[model samples]
Target: MLDFYTNPMSRGQTVRWMLEEVGADYQERLMNWGPSMKGTDYKKINPMGKVPAIVHEGRVVTECAAICAYLADAFPDAKLAPPPAARHDYYRWLFFAAGPLEQAVTAKSFGWTPTKEQSGVAGFGTYDLVVETMEGLLLSRAYVCGDAFTAADVYFGAQVLWGTRFGSLPSLHAFTDYAERLKGRPAYQKAKARDDALIAEGQAST
Candidate 1:
C-alpha cells in the first residue's frame, strides 16, 4: 500500500491530486507543522523535514515533481505518462516546471529579482522570461505535454493554480485559462475539496 505523509495546506495537495488522478489507494499520515513534521520519527522519512513524502513498496519518494513522475510510471494503467518513446516534451516541460519555473516563482515570493549580471547564474534568468516562456507553451497546446493531460500537468497546473491565486505569478490570460482547465478536472476537484475541508475543520477548532 502507498503511504502518504502530508499536511492539508502544504504542497501535499499536489501529491493528493496526483494520487487521485492515478486512482491509487493511499493511507495519509497528516503531519502538522513544527514538531510533528520535524521530529526524529518523520525525519527518517524526509530529512528535510517537509510534508508530501511517500513510502511506496518500501521505497521513499520525496519532492513533489519526483513523486508525480513516479506515480505515473508506477501505475501505468492511468496513462498519466506518455509512452517512453514520445516523452520529448513530456520530460522537457516537467523539469522546466520543477526547476527554472519553480525557482522563479519562489524568487518572486521572496520579493527577490536577480540583476542582469546575477541572472546569468540565477538559472531561471528572470521571472518575466520564465513566465513568458511558460505562457507561450500553454498558449500553443491544451496541456504541458501537448494535446493530452499527463502527470506533468499535475505539477505544472498546480504552479499556475496556486501562483495565480496567491499573486506569486501574474494573472495573464494564458495562465488564467490554463488554471480554469485544470480546475475542471475531477481529480483536482476531489483533492481540493479534501484539503479545503481540512482547512475549514482546523479553523473551526481554533
Candidate 2:
C-alpha cells in the first residue's frame, strides 16, 4: 500500500483526488504545518518539508504533478494516461500547468506582478498571457488532452479549481464548465468529503 503524507488544507488534496481516481488504497498520515511537517522525520520524505509526498515500494515521490503522474502510471489499469504515441498534449499541458501556470498564480497571489520587460525573462511570459493561454486550451476540449480524461486533468483541474476558488484565476465559462465536470466525478466527491471532514476536525481541535 502507498503511504501518503499530507495536510488537509494543502496541495495534498490534489494527490488524494488522484489516488481516489485510480482507486488506489493508501494509508494517509496527516501532518500539521509547523512541527509535524518541519520535523526531521517528515523532512526525510521531502527535504523541502512539503505535504502531498508519497512513499511506495520504498521510493518517495514529491511535488503534486509528479505524484499524480506517478500514480497514473503505477496503476495503468486505471488508464489515466494516454498511450505513448498520442501523449503530446497530455505531457505538454501537464508540465505547462505545473510550471508556468503555478508560477503565475503564485506570483499573483503575492502581488508580485511582473513588468512587461521582466515578463520576457519570466518562465510564464506574463500572468495575463498564462491565463489566456490556459483559457484557450480549455475552451477547445472538455479535458486537457481532449474528450478522454487523463491524469493530466487531475493536475490541471485541481489548479483551476483552487485558482478560481481563491480568485487567482478568473471564473470564465470554460474554467467553470471544466471545473463543474471535474466536480461531478465520484472520486473527486469522495476526496473532497474526506478532506472536508479532516479540515473540520483540525479546526475543532484548534
Predictions: Cα RMSD each: 0.8, 0.7
lDDT of candidate 2 over 101-165, digit per residue (tens): 99999898888999989998999988899999999999999999899999999999999999888
Error of model 1, residue 77, in angstroms:
0.3
For candidate 1, which ten residues in a row score worst on lDDT? 138-147
Q: For candidate 1, write residues 1-206 as lDDT tens digits.
A: 99999999899999999999999999989999989899999999999999899999999999999999999999999999999999999899989989999999889888899999999998899999999999899899999987899999999999999999999899999999999999999999999999999999999999
lDDT of 1 at 90: 86
lDDT of each: 0.95, 0.94
TM-score on alpha carbons, each prediction: 0.98, 0.98
Q: What is the overall TM-score of model 1 with all chains considered together?
A: 0.98
Report residue 32 deviation for candidate 2 (angstroms): 0.9
